[model samples]
Target chain A: MEFTVQDKGHYTEVAANGRLNMVAAPKLRKVVDEVVNGGGKRIVVNLADTSFMDSSGLGALIGCLKLARQSGGDLRIAAVQPQVTMVLELTSMNRVLTPHATAGEAFGND
Target chain B: MTDILARRTLEEPAAEQAIEDLHVLLEQLWLDAAFVPAPDQMAFTTAVIEAASNVVQHGVPTEGATLLLGVELTVAVERLRAVISEIGAAPLDPVPDLAGPSDLPGPDDDALLEDYDESGRGLSMIRALVTTVTVEREGDTNVWVLSRDSGQG
Candidate 1:
């Protein structure tokens, strides 16, 4: 997976593209660590361009959420496609983590 | 490749050959379930590959210990069901209480990500795809039941 991190002042937007599978999960975890270590709490993961997410990918996201929350911040998702949305829904992630229609909405700007 | 199929098993080293054999099996099933969409097909294949690879790597230390993979493809008007079973290691828990992705952390977080070099996201992908997944352990065998909706295909 290719991830581009944008520093959005109060929150950081991590945009992920390509497949987030076992192979790419480590990079994701590293990125999350960078965000947390950098003291950026409020996070928005934009998955609009992400084509695939496996259990490993989901686990990484959850881990990041936990870390971010423990640090007094939260992780939100936006622009989830149908396939990835199906995974999130089947796993009941939509209930625990809020998914917005756009990055701006997740950031509470829209 | 005949249309009417019966069950079979293959045992090989953890080399590329084994993955190739698995691909062949998946290809046959994918062709049989033509109505299933591309994403579903890929998900199912990935799950099978992950499970099978796990058996080769963790379940059996030596190549002598055979990894049993059974495939059954049933087609109806509304759905296609593919059940893959393997005689291998018993997982900590096959059907984990996953309320949401946020409820649990990745194996890597808890330091459970074994073999960091290769992939350990089989169960994760399995949970991602498929309408329903049922995992059962009987004696020494682990069975994974996967079903995909043909209508959605």
Candidate 2:
């Protein structure tokens, strides 16, 4: 998977493309770490193009969420695909990640 | 013996690259077995990958042996099955707890997330996605068989 980071004024948007499996899980952590370390307070991971995700990927997301929280920032996910959504709902992590319809909508109210 | 409408198989060194290749093979399998419901395909694929990933990440190799990941995916009219094998690997010292967790962690279980074992989640996800999942040692290989009833009518 490839990630692109964009500063969306209020928050930074990191768009992830392709399958987010074990192969891409570590890369995700590296990218999220960069965002948090660079003073990114509110971050949104756009998963509009992420077609698949497994437990490894889900774990990475959870790890990233914790990292952001630890740094006094927040990490949110947006535009989750069906397969990704299934994993999240199955693991019940959806309650924590709470997929947003769009990157712009995440952290919009907060 | 059931008639297989579609089949895909792969045997390679158990590594991260194998997982990437397995993903491609699954996509091709769906093309040949498009009759399977989308939901079935999605769920079965996730279960297979989870099983395969488990092999790559956790399968221990014997002395001077290179572990190999072997996958056999088949689609029948009413079922989808996968045989994920860990070749050239040592026996599971402490066999995995295939029964999975009694109760999955919830959002309120934030403490669980703090020190979560991603590997454990992979096993639990597999159990939830497939109708039946089992692991057995066959000589030098540990075989994971996952079956999901499909053909949603």
Candidate 3:
């Protein structure tokens, strides 16, 4: 998966385009780590183009969430695809990494 | 014997690239077996990928042997099945627990994430997605068979 990290003013948007499987898991960690180290908190991973994700990808998301929280900020996911949504729901991780309809709405209520 | 509506197979070095290749093969299978329901396609595809990924990530090579990922996917009139082989690998030190859904972690996401094992999650997802899943040592390979009942109109 190719990740594009953009500074969206209030939050940094990391858009992943491609399958988010084991092949892309470590890359995600690197991108999120850079964002957190770059002083960009309030992160949002835009999964609009991510067609598939397995356990490895989910684990990466969880780790990134923890990193963001540890840095005194937060990370959220938005625009989840059908398959990705299914994995999240099956593993019950959706409760922690709730999906938003759009990136803008991820932190809208916060 | 049931008539196979579609079939795809692959053998590659057990690595990250094999997972991506398997995804492509799955897409081709779905196209050929377009009659299969979307839910079944989704669930079976997820199970196959999870099983293949486990081999790529966890299968240990035997002495002087290189590990390879082998996948055989088939779609019949009323079922979807995959035989994933961890070729040239040693037997699992501790055989995996192929228990049921009760093995899944509870709804506490915080605690779940704190001590989550992706390998374990992958196994659980495979079990939950397919109607049946089993692993056994076949010669130098650890064979995983996953079957999901489908095509019931």
- Alpha carbon deviation, residue A42, candidate 1 (Å): 1.8
lDDT (Cα, tens digit) per residue for candidate 3, span A26-86: 9999999999999988999999999999999999999999999999999999999999999
Model 2 over residues A1-58: C-alpha lDDT tens digits? 8999999999999999999999999999999999999999899999999999998999
Return the number of clashes found in candidate 2: 0
Interface RMSD computed for candidate 3 is what?
A: 1.2
lDDT of 3 at B62: 98
Candidates 1 onward: DockQ, in order: 0.09, 0.70, 0.76
Compute the interface RMSD for each candidate structure: 7.3, 1.7, 1.2
The most accurate candidate by DockQ is 3
In model 3 chain B, the worst 10-residue window by lDDT is B99-108
What C-alpha lDDT values do all the predictions have?
A: 0.63, 0.91, 0.91
Rank order by DockQ, top first?
Answer: 3, 2, 1
